[model samples]
Target: MTYTIGFLGTGNIAADMARALNGSGHKILVSQRNAKTAAALAAAMPEVTIAPNETVVANADILFLCLLARTAAQVLPGLPFRADQTVISVMVDMPLARLRSLCAPATDIVLTIPLPPIAQGGCPLPVFPDCPALHRLFGDRNLILPQPSETALNAHLAASAICATLLDQMMTTADWLAAFTGDDDAAQAYVAAMIRGYLSDRPRPGALPAALRGLSTEGGLNATLRAAMAPAKDSLRNGLDGFRPRLGLPLGPEP
Candidate 1:
């Protein structure tokens, strides 16, 4: 099936999802906000259409609530939603319960976190619990990481923030290496491949340190780099520690 998907916002990420699903045989309907973006997406994808904001909500079988965090409250109540529709929220830090209360009570509200790379089919798509509809939409294209409970969702939120932090640091390092080494493309490619390999080979449970144990070898490049990155990693750990209380999530056992 061809499901009617209504997108409530016209942000970059929202447009990216629309592009990812382009020509997938599904009908894509976008709200009349950010007229320029909506028009562009509609033009690019034959299946995409620009409808009045209210009309999109009422007509869509599945709603993608991509509104900005600041304005979702003001915009949500005004949309005409159907009782049996499935509403999937992409806004961060918004609880599922709050989303349920804001939308039509009969609709199933699910919270999801979608990274920018979804346009390239590499998104770290995180969803709460299980929903067959969501499974059909994103299960094939992205790494669908589902959390078991609200506590798990909070951890996922922290993970999302950590992803941004890590990416920023990685990009900055790549830029610095490019500037000093006079090989921008090579620097970025090297860093990207390094991180990908590291993540792919990461060990589980107590095996993590063992996996990284080779780094402590005497006078090695890895040892030198680990020393340089130690303070930054410690600071990140402290920041994550502070976030746990704010998220109301239990702390993992101390090592």
Candidate 2:
């Protein structure tokens, strides 16, 4: 059945989801907190309308709380929601208990991390305590993975947060290439294509060590790069370990 989906905060994540679900036959209502963004989204998608947060929450069949943790905490208490409405949240650090307390009238509340790639149908979307609405809307276009526990969900969260480091590395690599090639466009295109192929060829999780060893030929470019970045890799790991505490989760091995 078609549902009216509302987004409380129309930020990048919400906009991405709204864009992906635009023509999926669901009426999307967004709040006017960010008027320019809301208006832009309405113009870009079908059946997307801008409304007040109160109206959006009250009328929505499924409401996605996409606000930052602080904003959500401040705004959610005053919103009116039906006991039957399904609530989904994209805020990373908000606990399930806190969400339930704040959105008590809503019987079904799901916690998920809707990554930006879903907007382009690129990767699986992660949800905890599976909900049918997630599947009904996004399953066809992308993989809808209903994680069995929040522990598994946090692994996805960690990966999502690592994009900043990856981008930093990629830009550095591209810059070095451009320095040698003297052509920025050629350098960027080459680095992007190489990275795409590398991602596509990565081994299954359990066999990563073997795959890494196999990919680095003795005296090859991969080996040389690995050697050069060994120290940096250690530093990067130390930096990423900090994310777990911020999200209120234990630091541990990622799947």
Candidate 3:
């Protein structure tokens, strides 16, 4: 079914969603708060209309809250949100109780984390409370991982924070390859393709450990490199563990 989806904030996330939802038969209404992004989206997707937040909220069947936490706190209360409309929030660190309070009268509120890759589809969307609206809208292109609880969803959000660090490491590897091969573009392409291929080849559960074990051949370069990077891996684990308290998860068992 088609939806009149409105974006409350026209930031990068909003832009990406607009791109993803383009041609989905949904009437997309994006707020004019971020003028540049909203304009760009309207320009790129001629079907998307730029409107004031009030108009967007009033006309939309489903609204996506893509604003910064502070901006949301300042803006949401003033908007006219209908009780029948569905509201999905992508605001990081915003608690669900606070959101529900701010978006009162609109009882169908969903919390979800959508990555930038959502623009091109195939991104994993971690959602709380198992929203059917989300599945109906994005399930065709993305993986909708429904969490058992808000805490589980928050943990997924915390885990997603590691994406930047992983990308940084990929870039570093690409730079090293470029230094050796004298071909920057080729180095980047090769590194990206390598990672993509590896991931695509093992897209099933338990594939990670199996892949690691397979690659760790005795006396091989893979084993040597894996051993050398053991500390970095440990650091990644420690970093995730550190987020437990902040995400309301208890400390894991002692290692």
Candidate 4:
């Protein structure tokens, strides 16, 4: 059965989700806050259209909320929300409890983390302990990881913020390689494919240790590079652990 999916914000994640869902039979209604993005998405997808936030709330069967947590407090309470429509927040740092209060009377509230690659399928999608609505929407498209608690979801939230930085790091290396190869495209393709293949073949249960052991042969180039990069990796991990506070999330060691 087709559902009407309304997006309250047209930020990165929302845009990507709309892009991925394009051509699907579901009706996709989007809020007009980020007018440029909403218009572009509507123009690109037949099932998608731009609408006022209240209209989106009233018309949609499901709402994918991407508003900033800081502003959500000021914005959501003003709009009338239905008890029957499911509200799935893709915003970071905003707890389910707060969302419940703001979107009260609308009990089917859930939390979700969607990566850009979800449109292409095969990425890991994280949702709350008992949110079946999320699984129904994203389960077949990606690996569904049903986190046991909000804390667990937050841990994933911190970790999820690193994908772009990881890409940037890869691009830095690729740029250096471009200098040698005299072709940025070839260097990027090679680096991207190499890194992607490494990621694809990562060991299931004990990825970090298995990756270290598998890649670092004695006196090998991989071993040497790993040693040189240890500090940077540590910084990245530390930075991720502390990033939630910047997003206004309650920060404690991941439970």
| Candidate 3: tens digits of C-alpha lDDT, residues 1-255 | 788999999999989988998888889999997999999999889789999999999989999999999989999997899999999999886888999899989989989999999998988998988899899888998999999988888888888999999899999999999999999999999999988876852169887898888888898998998888889988998999988877777687743
> Per-residue CA lDDT of candidate 1, range 105-187, in tens?
54587878777778777677667766677778877877777778877777777767787787787899899999989998999
TM-score of each: 0.87, 0.91, 0.95, 0.90
RMSD (CA, Å), candidate 3 to true, equals 1.7
After aligning candidate 3 to the native by TM-score, how far in Å is the CA of 176 from where it should be?
0.9
Best by lDDT: 3
lDDT of each: 0.80, 0.84, 0.89, 0.83
Mark the 10 consecutive residues where model 3 has the least summed lDDT. Answer: 194-203
The numbered model that scores best in TM-score is 3
Backbone clash pairs for candidate 4 read none
Model 4 poorest ten-residue lDDT run: 246-255
Q: How close is candidate 4 to the true structure, as a TM-score?
A: 0.90
**Ranking of models by lDDT:** 3, 2, 4, 1
TM-score of 3: 0.95
In candidate 4, stretches whose alpha carbon ends up further than 4 angstroms from where it belongs are 201-203, 244-255
Candidate 3: segments with Cα more than 4 A from true spot: 251-255
lDDT over C-alpha atoms for residue 33 of model 1: 83
Model 3, position 245, has a per-residue lDDT of 77
For 8-122, candidate 4 gives per-residue lDDT tens digits of: 9887778888887767789999999798888888888989889888999888888999999988888899787999999999888688899999997898988888888876777
Error of 4 at 16 (Å): 0.8
